[model samples]
Target chain A: MGVTGRAKRGKTEGPILKKCSTGIKGLDEITGGGLPQGRPTLVCGGTGCGKTLLAMEFLLRGALNYGEPGVFMSFEEKPDELVQNYASLGFDLEGLVAQHRLVLEYVYIERSEIEETGEYDLEALFIRLGHAIDSIGAKRVVLDTVEALFSGFSNESILRAELRRLFRFLKSKGVTAIITGEQGERTLTRYGLEEYVADCVIFLNHTVSDQIATRHLRIIKYRGSSHGTNEYPFLIDQQGFSVMPITSLGLDHPAFTERISTGIPRLDTMLGGEGYFRGSSILVSGTAGTGKSSMAAHFVDGACSRGERCLYFAFEESQNQIIRNMRSIGIDLEQWVKKGLLRFHNTRPSLYGLEMHLVALHKEVERFDPAVVVVDPISNLVTAAAPKEVKAMLSRLIDYLKLKRITAFCTDLTSAGGGILEQTEVGVSSLMDAWLLLQNIEGSGERNRGLYILKARGIAHSNQIREFFLTDRGIALRDVYVGPGGVLTGTARIAQEARDAAASTLHRQEIERKQRELERKKKTVDAQIIALKTEYELEREELQQAVAQERLRDDVVMKESMEMARARQADAVPTTAGGKQGRGGRKR
Target chain B: MIAAEGKRVHNGDGEQWILRLYVAGQTPKCLTAFANLKKICEEHLAGQYRIEIIDLLVHPELAKGDQILALPTLVRKLPEPVKKIIGDLSNTEKVLVGLDIRPFK
Candidate 1:
C-alpha cells in the first residue's frame, strides 16, 4: 500500500488492482477493470434510479458469468419481487436459488416493531450474511438499501458506528460486496454510507432536461485504481443496466494501407485512382437534397459488390424507403439486404438521446461485425446532442471503427447555404480521414449537384468541382471545364459544349476552303508549265530540221558548183572513185 | 379495492375508522404502539373504530402493500384519505392529528 513510481500517466500496464469485471457494459472499462476484487462498493441514488437493479446485476453476472456464487440480503425488495423484476432481463433467479448457488434473503427491518432495548450492533446482520455466504459458497454479497435500518434508531452515532462495523465485517468475510443507499438531499448518501464503504463509491443520477429523462452514472471515487472520471450515460432496458463510456483511451488503433472503391467510378477517379483508405472515416457534408443518401447507398452497393458486409444507419428514412429511393438511382440495396450482406438500422433521432443512439449503434455494429458502416446524415445526432457530447461520441466511434479496421462513411447535413464547407453542428471535420462536400449549384435557371473532395489523407485527390448528374445507370460526371475559367454544369454545360462544337466546326470549314483554293492554283500552274514545255519541244524540233536542211543545201550548192566547174573534169576531183560508186548506187 | 368499479369510493360519512398497526414479532415497541393507538381511538372515537395488527415477521409481504419503510407504524385505512403515523405512536396529539380523528361534535 505504498507509493509507486511513474503511476501518474498510468503506464504500469499489469493488473494494478486485483479487479473483477462488473459484467456491465462499459462499467469495467470506467472502473479500471471493475470494482475492487474483495471489497464492498457503495451504490447510492435517488428513488427509482435503478440502484437495486445495478447491484443485482453485479451479483447475477458474478454468479452466472464468472461462476462466482453470490448472496443478496435485500433490505427493501423481497426475493419473489426480485425474481419477478429480473425475469424480464432473462435472469433466472429462481433457478439459481433452487441450485443453492444464489441466496436472496429479505431481512424485514420494521422501524416501529423493534424498540432499541439497549445498544445493539448489526452483528445479527453479519451472522445472517455469513450463513447465506457459507450456504452457497458465495464470493459476492449485496445489501440493498442498508439505510433502511436507520429508521428504527434513536441515536445517530449508534447507527453510524453500526454501519461502519457492518462494512468492516463484510470486508473481513473476504467477499466482494455491494451496498445500495438512497441519495441524501445534498450529501452522497442518506446516512453518509459513502464514508463507511470508502473503497469505491458509484453514484447514479437521473436528470430531466428538455422533457427527456437521461440516467447517468459516475464513479465518485475508487481507491487504489485510476478510474474514468466522467459522467457516463446508462440505460436500463429489458436486458438490465448497461453503461456507455465514450472513451478515447489514447487513440491506439491500428491503421491500414489498403484502399476501397467509392461506388461511383467517377468519384473514385476523383479520389486518386483507387478510392478511400481502408478503415478510414469519410464525411460527406451536404445540404438538403444534395444526394448524400444516394452517395451512401452507392457506397453500400459498392461494398456489397465486393462481397463485404455493410451496415447502413439511416436517421431520416426507413429501410424500405431508402431501398425504394435508391432503386431509382440504379443502386439496389434490397437484394443485398435479402442476401444478408447488408443491414439497415433506421431510427429517428428524437426517439432516444444521443448516448442511447450511440449504444444502440455500438451494439448493432458489434453484432453484425460489418466491414463497412455508413451513417446517412449524422447531423441528426448532432441535433439531438450537445456539441461536446457529439464530439466525444464521434471520436470514440472513430476509434472503435479504426480498431476494427472498418471503413465508415458518415454524412453530415449542413444548412442550406451558398457555399460548401459550411459550419456543421458537430464540427467533426478533424476526425475524418477523407471529406467530400456536396452542394446545390443553383444558377442559369437550374439546380445542379456539384461534388468535390475537400481533403483525402495519404492520397492526391482532384481539386476540381465535378458536376455529376444522377442517371438511370448511375452518377455520371460531366466534362465541366468549358474554358480556362468557365466551369459550366447541368444544362448550361450542355449548351456551352454544343456552342463550342459549332464554333470549332465553322473554323474547320474555313480551313478546308483555303486548302481547296490552294489545290486549284497548283492545278493551273501545272497546266501552264506543260503547255510551255510542249511549245519549247516543237520549236527545238524545227530548229534541228532547219539545221539539217541548211547542211543539205550547202552540200548541194557545193556539189553544183563542183559539177559546173568540173563538167569536163567529171570526174572532178570531188567525185573520186568512192563518190562515183556511191552516185551509181543511188541512180540504180 | 373494489373489482367491479374502476376506482374505489371511500366511505367517509360518520363511519367507524379502520386502522392497522404494523409491528415485528411482539416487540416492546409494537406493544406500546398498539396500546397507544387503542387508547387514542377509545378516547376520541370510542366504539366507532376497529384496529388490525399485522406482524411483519410472519407476513413480510404485507409491508410492501402498505409501503411500510418503518416498523410500528399506525395506518388510518378507511377515513377517506389514508394517513400514516410512523414510530410507536408515542405522541398522542400527533397521532390524532395524523389520523384526522375529532371528538364527536
Candidate 2:
C-alpha cells in the first residue's frame, strides 16, 4: 500500500488521496502522512482527554504553519474562552483570527430556551458553518465537541441525518475537518459519529496507572492508507501534543564501528582495548556505593573533553550535588557545563509520570542535540513506574538515542539482596550493547569495588574481574591477585604480599647461616689434617732415626757376629745373611 | 415583508408586541410559521403587535445576535423578557404557551 501510494503521488495520477499534514510532532510519521485530504476525521475520547485540544491544534497548525486558513466552530466553548485557553500554550489564536487566517465560530444551543412546534431541519447550522468556511476560504475545519447537538435537539433522526449531511457537506467543500465527539460506553462516539466520518478515526485515551497519568493516541482506522496500530504515548504541555512512536524506530539504526572511550583507560582496556561503540548503549549496574555514578560521570567527562556535547540526566541528585560529589573524585563536570559541552538535567523521578519523563527527555535531547547521554541510576525511575514500564521507557530512550547515533551511558543500582547481583532491577540489561557489572567485594573486614565486563557485543573483552577504585585523581582498575583461598583484593592481597616477602627473606637468612657453619667446620677439619700431617712427619723422622740407629747397631752386631762366625762357624752363614738383607730391602 | 397593526388595542396596558421571525431563505417552514403567528396575533393581541421577518441567507452575520440555529425561529424581542420558539409555529396552543400569549396556568 505504501509503495502504490508513493508511486501514485510521484506520478501525480489525478489526486491519489493526497495527505494533509497534521503538523504535530511524531504524529505524521505514525499515520504514514496526515489525515486524508478533503475528508472529515473523527477524534473521539472521554471527557478531559485532550480531544478538543487536539482538534484546536490541528486547525491552528493548519493556519499558522501550512498557511492554509482554518475554521474552528465550537459547540461547547465560546471563541473567547478558546482563545484564552490556547494562549497559555503559546498559540496566538486571536492573532490568527486578526490576520484573517482563521475563523472562530461558537454555536450556541439551549434546548430549554426553545420550544419546537412543528417539523424542522438544521439548515441554519449548515448555513452558519458554510458561511464561516467561505468567509476565510478555509482549507481546514474543526468542530470541537459536535455531540452538543445531540443533547440540544429532541429528534435523533433529524440530528443523525443532519450530521451525516454535515460530513458530506464538509467533504464537498474540500475542507479537511476534525469532528470531535465524547466517547460512548460501547461505540467510539456517543452518537456514533464514527459511522459518519469513516475515512479516518483516532482515539485518545488518558489512563492513570499507580497514580501516574499517561495519555495515549491510537489510530483506529484509516481508509486507503497504512498506519501504525500501536498505542503511542502522547504528551501535552506548554508545547502542543507530541506523540512518541518509539516502536517505529525498529532495530534499523545504523551500526557504527567508531569506538568511544569509557573515560577510564584501564576500563577501556577491559573492553577490547578501545571502548563502547559510538552509538551503543552501555549499562553500568552495581550495588550502592560501587561507583556507578562515578563511572558514568567519567564517560560524560570523556565525551565532553573530546569536544562533544553530553547530556546528563541526574535522577537522584541535583546538579550542584552531582558536581560536588564528582569533584571529590577529581572529575570536574562544572567546567564542561560552563563550556556548554555538558548539560545537566536534574529531576526527581517522582516529579512526573513515566511517560512525561520520557517526553521531557526527548525534548531535552532534541534541544541539546548531544552526542552522548547519561542517565545516572535508572533504578530510581522504577519507583515512579512499574519495572516493566521502566524497561519499556528505557528501551524507547535507547532506541531514540541509537537512531540519532548518540552514545547512551546509563547507570543502574542493584539491591544488595539475595537476588542475583549481576541482574539489574529494571531489567534493561538485555537492551544494552555493552554491560559493565560493578560489584562490592567484601573480605578481610574491608569492602572494595570490583568491575567486570558482563557482555560486550562484537568486541573481545576481558573476562577478568579487575579491582575497581575511585582514587583522588580518577578511577583506577588493578588486576586482582589470586591467593591460596581465592581471588584476593585490597588489604588481603597486600598482607599476603608482605607475608611472602618476609618468608623469602627468612629463607635467604637461614641458607646463609648454614653455609657459614659448613665453611667453619671444613676449616676445622683441614686444621686437624694439617696437625696429623705434621705429627706423621715427626713420627717418620723418629722412625728413620731409630731405623738408622738400629741399622748401625745391627751392622755393628752383624760385623761382630760375622767376625765370630768367620772365626768359628761358617762362611755359608755370612752368604745367607747377605741374601736375607737384600730380601728385607726389597720388602721395604 | 413586515406586518404592522399598531392602531388597534385589545389587551391590558395596550403594550405593543414585537415579534421577530428568523429564516435562512423562503422555505415552506418559514411561510407556515409566519401565517400561524399572524393568525394568533390577530385573535389574541389585535393591533398591538408587529412581525419582522429576517432572512439569514441575505445577512448571515445576524445569526450571532439572536443565537439562532434552527429554521423558522420566532423570537419575542419586545415583551420585556425574550422568548424563543423554534420550528414552524403550526401548533397554536403550544406557540401561545411558548410566547406567553396565554401563559400555561
Candidate 3:
C-alpha cells in the first residue's frame, strides 16, 4: 500500500487520485479498491445508520491493515465513548491512542454555548487536526459527525466556506479522510457537505422492511474512480462492518470443463451422463414433495464421497431436520456432517431480507471452501423479499458460485399455487446452465414423481421423462417406457403395459388359430386338387390314347393306301389314265 | 451601535460596568458562564454593572461585528479596553483576571 501511495505521489506534483483499501469486507471491492486516496470522502447517514462506525472502521482498518496511522476527530461522541463503543468491534482505540498510532481528538461543541460571533476561519480545528496528523504521521482521518459543530454556528455561509476549506486542507495534508454527517431532509447531508466534498460520497441507510431491520451502504458518487453504484446490504456483527457488494465482481467467470455428479446416477444420466459443469449453475425445479431436497442430499453425499466440501443452505428446514430427514431416505447426511465434509446452514426465510441471506450465503461459501453448494428450495427466498429482489439476489449468488468454479445445485419448489409447472417465482432458470425439472404426475388415483432435464446447456442429455421413486435405498429413476400412449407413468403405465401384453398374447393366439385354419383349408384344397388332377389325368390319358389310336389307324390306313397305290402304280404304270382314276376314287 | 469609547454608553457618570456574554443557545456551558459572570459582578461590581447576554444563534451577524470565535466567551466592554475569555469561564481566576477585575496570579 505504501509503495502504491508513494508511486502515485511521486509521479506528479498534481494529486494523483489513487484508491486506498478500506480493509472492511466488500467495501474495497464496492469502491473499486476503496476511497480516493488523500481525498476527503463524505460519509453521511441518518441516526443509527452506522455512520460513525463506518468512519471509525476506515481509520482503524487503515491503521491495522495498511500500516497507516489514523486520526479520529469526534465532534459528537467523546473519546472515551468512542473507545467504549468501538471496543465491541475489537477496535482497540485506547491501545492505538497509547501507541500514538491513532489520535482521538474529541471536538464536542456545546450547541447552546458556541457563538459564531465573527468570521472565523476554523483555524482552531485545523490546528488541532494538523497537530494530530503531525504527532502520528497519520495518513487517514475520521471526522465523525463534524457537521454537529455547525449546530452552534448561526452563520451558515462562513461554516459552509470553512467546511470546504477543511476538506481542501485535509486533502493537501495528503490524508485519506472520512467525514461523517447527519442525513439531511432534502440533501445527502444536513448541511449539504456533499456539494463541497465531491471526491467521494457514501450513504448509509438503516430501514426496517417488513419489521426486519436491514442496513444498506451505497456509494452515492465517486469522482475519478469507478465504484459500485448499487445499494449493497451490509451487516454489523462481531467482525465490525461488512458490506455485501452483490455483483461487484462482474459475470466474467472462467468456464470450466470439469464436471461433478448430481449424486444420483440417473440424475447424472439425465444431465448428459456427467453431473453439472464444475463452474455451472443447475436448478432443480419441482412442486411440493418432488424429491428436490433428496436430489440435493444426493449431490451433497456425492461431494462428500469425492472428499470435497459441500455447503448446504436450508431455508425451510433446520440442520438436524435435514440430516434426519435425509437419513430416512437412506442418505446418511449425518455421517458427512460429522466428517466435516458437509456443512448445513439453516435460517428462517422471514428472518431477514433477501440480501441478508445472500450475504450469509457468500460468507458460508467462502468459509467452507466448498466444491459444491446446494440451497434447498431456493424458492423459499421468494417469501423473504420481493420477487425482483429475490431474483437479483440469486443472480448475484449464482454468479459468485460460477466465478469460484464451485458446482452449484439449487432447488426451487415451484410453488403449488401456480398455473405452470417448474416455474419459480424468481424465474431464475435463464441464469442456470442446466435445469432438472421434477414433477408429480398424479393420475388413476395415485401420484408418481417424475424427473426430467428440461435443458442442459452443453452435452447430449436424455430427453426422456424418467419416473423417479424414493425408497429405502434412495431415489431411483425408471427407464423411459414410451408406447402408443406417448410417455407413461405410475400405475397407468403398468396397467397399459399389462393390457398391451394381454392383447399381444390374444393376438398371437388369434394369429395361430387363423394359421391353423389356413393349414386345414390348404389340406382340403390339396385333396380336392389331387382328385381332380387324377380325373383330369385319366381323361387326358384316355383322350391321348384315343388320339393315339386314331393316329395309328390313320397311319396304318395311309400306309396301306400308299402300298396299294404303289402296287397299283407299279401294275398300272403302263395304264396312267386308269391309275389316276383309281387314285381319285380312293381320295373320294 | 459603534461605541469606540467603552465608557460612552454610561455618559461617564460614574460609568456603568458593561459586560457582554456571547452564547449560542441556553446550553449548560452558557448557563455556567452566565452564573459565574453574575457571581463575580455581584461580589465586586454590585449594582453598578450591567450584564448583556447575546445569543449568537439569534444574531449571527453580530459574530462578524465583534470578531468572536470560541463559545461562552465573556467580553468586558467597559474600562476603556475590551478583554475576552473563552470556554465556560470555569477557571474563576482566569475569568476574573481576563475581565481586569483582578490581576493574574
Candidate 4:
C-alpha cells in the first residue's frame, strides 16, 4: 500500500503505534503515551539517579495498573534488596511475585572466580532470561545495569556482540525491555552501549546547581516515535521516580464544559469570570502572610460544597493546623472531611525522597480520585528536592490530574521582594498553566492584600491586580486603585518608600553638613596641594642639581683616570729607552 | 509377581536377550553397567544371554528411563528373562533370578 493511503487506512484500523504505559505519572506524556511497545529502551544514569527506581516503577505499574506481567533482571542487587528498598515506597514486589505478576532474577557475575574455559558463551544467560520471561509470560522486562557482563570478561568485542544478540533476542521475543546502563562522565554509558543496541535511549542526570541537587531526564533518542525533547525534571521521593512533563499534553484531551466557583464570590470575580477550568493547574505564588493558602482552601471548599471530592496535600501545614487556621477565616474543612468529600495528605518535606512523594501522591490520587487536588505551598517541596525535581513532580501530578479531569491548585511561597513569575530554585515558572500572585499592599496605614492573575493558559484573564482582603468572613476582592506608584507594589514597596523618604531627609541634612565639612576640608586640601606642589618643584630642582653633581663627579673620575694613564705612560719613558737599547742590542 | 520361566544352559541356550540400563548422568552407578554385564556373562549366561547396555545420559530422549524412574536400572529382555533390577547390581542371586538364571529344582 502507498504510505499515505496506508496511513489513511490505518486510521480506520486504529492506532498502529503500540504503546506500553510507563506506569509513571508524567512519563507517558513525554514518551507520547509511553515507550514503544516490544522494543528495548536504554535507561542510562548515574548511581542513585533513579534508573532502578524507574525500572521498578515501570514493572510495578505494569502489574498493578495495566495488569501486564513484568520481569526484573538485576545485576547488582538481589530480589530481596529490591523488595526492601521499595518497601517504604509501598511497592510490594514480593507480593507481586507471589501473585505471579512479576519476577525478579539476580544475575551475579563473580570476576575473581570466572575462568574462561573457551567453551562458554552467553547462551546460559540468554537461557535463564528466556526461562524467566517464559515462566511468567512477562510482557515487560528490565535488566538493571546489564553492563556487569563486562566485569567478568575483559573482551569488549564479545560483550558488545553478546549484548547485540541479547537486544535482538529480546526484540524478536516481542518484550518491551529496559536495559539500564551506569552513566559515565561525558558519556551516556561507560562503553557507549547506548549507541549500539537499542531502539531508545534515555539519559538521567542528577546535577547539583547552586547547592540544590535535582534529577532530570531527557529522551536522547527513540526510533520510530515522537517524544518530548525537553529535559524533564523528576523527583525521587518515597513513592518512586516521577518525571514532570508539564505542558506537553495535546489539546485533544476532553475539556470540562462547566465552570466551578472559587468558594468566595469576591475572589471568583477576581478570576475575571468564575473559577478556573477543570483539569487546569493553578499556581498561587506570594510572599508569606499573603493568604495564598487561604485562597487555595477557598477553592477546595468550593469543590467540596458542590459534593465533589477534593484532596488537599499540605507541605507547609498539618491538617489540624490548616483546619484551625482556616476556621478563623470561616473555612471549616473539618465538615467536608466529615462528609468524606475532603481528604488531607500532610507530610513533612524531609520525610521521603522526591519519587516517594510522587508515589504517595499517585496512591492518594488513585484511592481518593478527587475532582480537585490542592498542594499548599509547593515551595516547601522544592526544599526537599531540586527545582527540576519539583517541576517534574508537579508536571506528573498535573498530567495525572488532567487525565482524570481534576482541577489542581498549588501555592508557592516566594521571597518578599521577588517577582511573581520568577521561580526561585529551578526556574520552572514557564510550566504553570495559570499563575496567581498575592501580595501585601500598603493602603491607608494598613497592609491590604492584593491579587493578580499573571498568566492563565487557554483562557483570557484580567491583567490588572485587584485589591483583596482576608477577614473573618472569607477572602474578598476589591477594585485596584492605582496611586502614585503602580498597583500591586505592595507593603514592602511602601516600606521602601517610607525608608527612602527618611533616608532622603537624613541624606539632605547629612549632605549639607558634609558640604560644610567638605568646604573646610577642600580649603585644607588646597593649601596642602599648594605646599606639596611647591615642595615638589623644590625637590625637582634638588634632584636636577644631584644629577648634575653626579655627572660632574663622573667627568672628574674620567679625567683623573685619563691623566693617571698619561702620567704612567710618561713615567714609562725609561722603559722606552730600555726597549730602544734592547732593539739596538738585538741588531748588534 | 509370578515365576514365569526357568532356563539353564551350560554352553549356549540359543536365545538372544535384550537388556536396558537407566542412569541420570555420568556417575559411578552409571559406569558399572559394562563391568556388571561382563561378570554376569562369564558366570551365568556364558553364550546364552545377549545383553544390551543403554546410557540414559546420552539418550535422554528414550522413554525407558522415565517409565521406571529409577537410576542405574537394568532390564533383561530375552531367554525368558522377564525381571527388572534397580540399583548398582551388587547382589548376584537377586540379579541372577532377575535375568531368569535360577537353578532348576
* Best-fitting candidate, scored by lDDT: 2
| Order of models, best DockQ first | 2, 3, 1, 4
In candidate 3, what are the lDDT values of residues A1-588, reduced to their tens digit?
999897876765565568989999899998888889999999998999998888889899988889999999877787899889999888889999998889887765655433233223454466567777887999999998778757766667767887888888998999999998899898899888898889899999987756667788999889877788898878887788888777887878899888888778877876778877887888889988999999889888888999999999988999998888988889999888889998989898998777668878988998889999998878888777767767877888888898888888899988675759857668898989889888887666788888888988886888888998899889988965677745677888888879889999999999999999999999999999999999999999999999889768756765676678787775444344654576568657
Tell me the TM-score of candidate 1's A chain: 0.82
Residue B72 lDDT (model 3): 68
Candidate 2 local lDDT, A394-510, one digit each (tens): 999999999999999999999996569888999998999999999988788898999989999998999999997898888999889887787788999788889889999999999
User: Which regions in candidate 1 have their CA more than 4 angstroms from the true location?
Assistant: A1-16, A248-250, A382-384, A418-421, A482-487, A502-588, B1-105
Q: Please provide, for model 1 over A178-272, each residue's C-alpha lDDT reduced to its tens digit, 9 standing for 90 to 100.
A: 99999999898988888899999999998876555678899998998888888888888777888877672557777788999999888888888
What lDDT tens digits, residue by residue, belong to model 4 across residues A68-187? 899998889987899999998998889999999998887765554332311123544565677678778999999987888888665567667878888889998899988899987888
lDDT of 2 by residue, B2-105 (tens): 12223234333655689999987888988888888899988878767789999989988888788887888899997767888988889998998898766665
Weakest lDDT window of 10 consecutive positions for candidate 4 chain A:
A112-121
lDDT of 3: 0.81
Find the 10 residues in a row with the least total lDDT in model 3 chain A: A112-121
Which runs of model 4 end up more than 4 angstroms from their true locations? Answer: A1-29, A32-39, A50-108, A114-146, A169-176, A207-214, A233-244, A251-257, A267-285, A350-359, A386-403, A417-437, A443-445, A450-470, A475-588, B1-105
Please estimate how well model 1 matches the true structure, expressed as its whole-model Cα lDDT: 0.81
**Candidate 1 docking quality: incorrect, acceptable, medium or high:** incorrect
DockQ of each: 0.03, 0.58, 0.05, 0.01
Measured against the true chain A, the candidates' chain A TM-scores are 0.82, 0.82, 0.89, 0.64
Instruction: Give the worst 10-residue stretch by lDDT in candidate 2 chain B.
Output: B1-10
Docking verdict class for candidate 3:
incorrect
**Relative to the true structure, how large is the alpha-carbon lDDT of every model?**
0.81, 0.89, 0.81, 0.75
Q: Which ranges in model 2 have alpha carbons more than 4 Å from their true place?
A: A1-15, A482-486, A496-588, B1-15
TM-score of each: 0.72, 0.83, 0.80, 0.57
Model 3 clash pairs?
A: A117-B63, A118-B63
